[model samples]
Target: MNPIFKNILAVIVGLFVGSVVNMAIILISSTVIPPPDGADVTTMEGLKASMHLFETKHFIFPFLAHALGTFTGAQATALIAANHKTKLALVIGAFFLLGGIVNVFTLPSHIWYNVTDLVFAYLPMAYLGGKLIKKKKS
Candidate 1:
């Protein structure tokens, strides 16, 4: 396989897996975690509001989702290219984790912000997952 093609595929796989994991964490965790103070914690109400915005904007989530995918895909590609080192994973995870934390704080909605947070929680875990996946396949 060409290195460029392989790299792109690696990124796609990583982004896909990351997005699914992000969604799962967001949906499931929302049920249990209390809303941040001064923010709405009600899932139904929050989702309704989100839907309204999504319906009107029509592009925010898709754009954001794909952007997240792009970033995650890049991370995965980097991880895979790094020869599956835990140290590399840790460093990559840390960068993403910090970036995620910063993003969470910037987001206005408690829920969406937290969704990003949940997505980020997997940064380190994703690296670990990569290690396991790469290990078995190789």
Candidate 2:
């Protein structure tokens, strides 16, 4: 198989896996935290409207969803890439970071939550994932 094709496939698979992980966590989160009463969390507008009602504890699942999803995606990319493992992982991170940025703009949240999620979630987790792959290979 061509290395380029393999790399592309790795990226696709990584993104898919990461997105699945993210959605899974988000789905489970509703069960665990249960959104505020009458929050109508099914739509972006509804969620944004309900954001003010959320407590500090409600943010934890989202952070975990983002971080763990990025980590799992980066690790998958690193393991599957033919070369430039770290670069591939970073690419995944950047993709997720862009999504996070979009999320911030689209859905208003607490300033602290926005800052923490933006700063700590994507790149750091991706780097850790790549490092884990490297360590395992070594």
Tell me how candidate 1 scores on lDDT: 0.49
CA displacement after TM-score superposition, residue 117 of candidate 2 (Å) = 0.8
| C-alpha lDDT (0 to 100) for residue 71 of candidate 2 | 92
lDDT of 1 by residue, 34-127 (tens): 3333444355556444443332133244334433543454356555653534444444455556656665464444565457445645464546
How high is the CA lDDT of each candidate model? 0.49, 0.92
Best by lDDT: 2
Give each prediction's root-mean-square deviation over alpha carbons: 9.6, 0.8
Point out where model 1 deviates above 4 Å.
Answer: 32-99, 107-123
Q: For candidate 2, lDDT tens digit of each residue in 29-104?
A: 9899989887989998899889989999899999999999999999999999888888898899999999999999
Clashes in candidate 2: how many? Answer: 0
Query: Looking at candidate 2, what is the lDDT of residue 97?
Result: 95
Provide the global lDDT of candidate 2 against the true structure.
0.92
